[model samples]
Target: MKGKIIFFSVFFLLTTGAISAQAKNAPRSIISTTALIRKYHDQKELSGMQKGELLELYIERIKVLVKTLPYIALVTKPGVTMADLGIPDDSEHKKSLENQALGTSTFLDTTVDFQRKMMPYSDKANLIAAILFYEGTLKSLHEFNELNEM
Candidate 1:
């Protein structure tokens, strides 16, 4: 019984330590374009111009995602007023929403272009990690906006 208890305690501590390490190494909430460009260049052997183009694509994608999130949330959530969702009830908001949606759609279309261009050269694991991080960021943003309405 004593041996079993010690084994379990050691196992639990090791498991928790591994989890904590992984959580610590996870990326920050905001993606840095410069850092990403440097990483792409270093990891993928991308030329300066290629890195610049990739960074531009990334920035454009993120801009669309961030800009559309509030509008998307507003459109989806019932009983939530635009004001409550941080959207103004004006032509400006409508124009912004329209532009953001269009831009986000265009960004999604370019995902294939980016993948075809970079997937062969890029570190697959790093690319996947970056994608997951961005997805998590978007999820967090939506959840935060939703909670604010409550």
Candidate 2:
């Protein structure tokens, strides 16, 4: 009985160690931009168009980011160029992340006017909450990406 118990305990310990090692070195999964907009963020207070445009801009970024994340993880240099990402040109990518901060949608002026109406109390709070959650997820993924070298 004592010998059997010893054998099982050693087996269990080895299995646990293997599992821990695999977890520590696991590849991190990044969230899709569409899910981040629809499922993750709380945009109930935002107008439908406002919500859609916000989602659209991030979706565009995500598409490019998904392709470039490996390259991004490999390099720490600022302003990752088209050559780095193996793109014909990065104008489209540059344009996507740009107009967002400026609130100018190049797709449709009617869809998104560069209007900055004051947000209501609840909307402001909710927007901040959603952004924090999204930011946290991105930060985690970025940290994991950086950890590959270490």
Candidate 3:
């Protein structure tokens, strides 16, 4: 009985410690686009490295968004084919998109790893602003495409 009691106590302590550690290391929540824009306006001029990081984030996000173009068309427009979105129905195009997705996935992994390493406050605002800008641009493009189709 004493052995079983000691084992449970040890397990409980280990689990609690692990939980607390994970809580401490949890990723920060994503800030809103509005807040990011506000912060971006207040930021000082970015250094070359910061500009490079921002550009990388923007390009990676655009690649991912492009990968979703076909699916977005299918859902938003009934009976729409890939050709309607100017996406080739051939295997080569499919393979190219798949390859792009894999590359984008790798870029995202490295980005998340960097963020986990505690990126600088200045870099974070620039990164977030780039993300918001690209996302908004894609949204606007999608809307424009829809209007043109009508």
Which candidate wins on lDDT? 3
Higher lDDT: candidate 1 or 2? 1
10 residues in a row with least lDDT, candidate 3: 28-37
Model 3 C-alpha lDDT per residue in residues 41-138, reported as the tens digit of each score: 21244333355566555555555454444444343332444465566567776566456556656865776566545444445666766677666765
For model 1, what is the error of residue 117's alpha carbon versus the real structure, in angstroms, after optimal superposition? 1.8
> Candidate 3 has what TM-score?
0.34
What is the lDDT, from 0 to 100, of the residue 124 in candidate 2? 42
What's the distance in Å from true for residue 11, model 2?
A: 81
Q: Mind giving the per-residue lDDT tens digits that candidate 2 earns over 120-142? A: 22354444454445545555655
Candidate 2: residue pairs that collide: none
Which parts of model 2 are misplaced by more than 4 Å? 1-78, 86-118, 147-150
lDDT of 3 at 106: 85
> Residue 39 in candidate 2 has what lDDT?
35
> How far in Å is the alpha carbon of 1 misplaced in model 2?
99
Tens digit per residue, CA lDDT, model 1, 52-135:
454554554455454445444344332344465565557676566456557655866687567657665765454544544565
lDDT of 1: 0.52
Q: Candidate 1 regions off by >4 Å? A: 1-97
lDDT rank, highest first? 3, 1, 2
Give lDDT per model, in order: 0.52, 0.46, 0.54
